[model samples]
Target: MTPHPPTWIRVSECFLSLQGEGPAAGTPAHFVRLQGCDVGCHWCDSKYTWGKSGGREISIDDALDEVRSLGEAPMLVITGGEPLQHEGVYALLARSLGRWSRVEVETSGVEPPRMSHAHLFWNVSPKLPSVTPRWADTWAHARAWAQAPNATFKLVVGSERDRDDAVRLIAEHEVPAARVMLMPEGLTDDVVRAHAPIVVEACKRHGYRMSPRLHIWLWGPKRGV
Candidate 1:
């Protein structure tokens, strides 16, 4: 019998680093940044990952093995320009089930999750009005994510309008307050710190959690941890 062909996906890069944002912040994780995205955020830190032009195609096995070679990773973080946009990601996660204690997916919630796993945790960031193709355009996907018990909401807020928009999304989607996290938006440590106070105050009043830019604090805008 003939062997099956290896599944491939465009990869921007892979690195073992501390999860920088969301509820899993500070946790040591092997990050798999798949390339390609259409939900454009003007302030996107990873504009380099906007398309397949910069990334190379790699098989799911090779991708996991590379991260494993990096050493012991406490968790696997499948992030992206938009991870769900890549079909091979579903296979990657399916294969990662027993390898990592848990798997975290950081998505813009623009594309729907095609499969669900018991140990998979989704950090769904619903885009606010500040970005094009923002939350209003893709909120249905977020609503779908909220329906899953393992999903968490991470709202990156930089202004009062963004904060208000986050609140409106939470209410409309019926997302649990305890499962919501507010992260400051910035590419530099100073900028992230400066915006943190607003997030802290917002979390305090709303009973939401605060997610720090731990990787930014540790590496200061550097890539690949």
Candidate 2:
């Protein structure tokens, strides 16, 4: 008898929602939030997902069933505490690619993704110096993704210092300015508004595009949006 392919994936949560950040913002998508990350960004909105034990394991078939249940989402977004941290994500991404027209993976840029399907869009968000105990591994992953045809660099800018770090990273990795998105770092609409001008100025100064946190603006910082 042939052995069965692994059916399980470590997942934090799954829901259907609009793509909140990046160039794909406003596009309706199915979100598969995987569990665990060590990047430990100070302003991470998904703090609940930081621990592997905090998430439940579900069969890959069941996860795909949930995606199909979403009706006709334009894409499948595999996000996380950091999706690349899970080895099973490769299988999940591969399976999703067969069904969805587009598959987007949002990662912290700490580890290189194992799967590199043509349809996979890598949204690499590398943490700035403020994130603490920075990982040296982020550079290799960032460099690889920078060269990827379907990848974009979405840097979260909280201060002028963060903006400087972003510029350095973009230049070092040779990421295209057009493919780079500078997002204001905030969870609330008020905070976002306060930081918007600074981020917009940074974008203009550096020739990068500005990405707004649409989900937070529409629904605050609540879950399952």
Candidate 3:
């Protein structure tokens, strides 16, 4: 018998554009921005996603239809308030989109997906103190796929304290330094310029990789960008 893949997930926005963050930066891609998050980052740009009412809920099929409408982008980025917190959405998205595209999920690492297939790239952007321990709680599940090249762990830093905290978290998890990325707190260009150089220097000093916010540079904190 053929195995059944997960169902598609409901989402907020589905569009095509250049990936603006993580290792996939500059890559033209399709984005599936799922709504609703509880990670609680004071500086979160997508706070609107925390409320279910903020985005209209669509069926998994409709979401796929929207993606299909965009034609070919080769890559798909599934991001959310906290993607892992909503299992069915991304899993269905991953299974359905995997048929024709290279898929990636940008998560807070606060929850585990019920299903995570090999074809889907897992981008774990673990939140800091501004968020909750739930972010750290997802590490065990993510570590299960730690060996997969498609999986990358990222940390967003706002201050020197955040940098120190990220270092300790990476070490505690025994996650490979190479697999970890240090991203600046990029709410605005001024925010990026204010702290990006410091974070970049810190990345160099710590020998960790850095991830810049491509979306911010391309478009300020606007939606569907």
Clash count list over all predictions: 0, 1, 1
What candidate 2 gets wrong by more than 4 Å, as runs, is 1-5
Estimate candidate 2's alpha-carbon lDDT, on a 0 to 1 scale.
0.84
lDDT of 1 by residue, 153-219 (tens): 8888887778888888788878888889998888888888788888888889989999888877887
Residue 207 local lDDT, model 2: 94
Clashes of 3: 1
RMSD of 1: 2.4
> Model 2, residue 34: displacement in angstroms?
0.5
Q: Estimate, for each residue in 1-225, the C-alpha lDDT of model 3 and write its tens digit.
A: 975545645477888888887888888887878888876777788877887556766666777678769877778787887676664664466456545557888877666544556667778876666555555565555565456557788788888888888888777777788888888887788888788877888788778889889889878898887
Error in Å for residue 110 of model 1 = 1.2
RMSD of every prediction: 2.4, 2.1, 2.9
Error (Å) of candidate 1 at residue 182 is 0.6
Clashes of 2: 1
TM-score of 3: 0.86
Global CA lDDT computed for model 1: 0.84
By summed lDDT, which 10 consecutive residues of candidate 2 come out lowest? 131-140
Candidate 1 regions with alpha-carbon error over 4 angstroms: 1-6
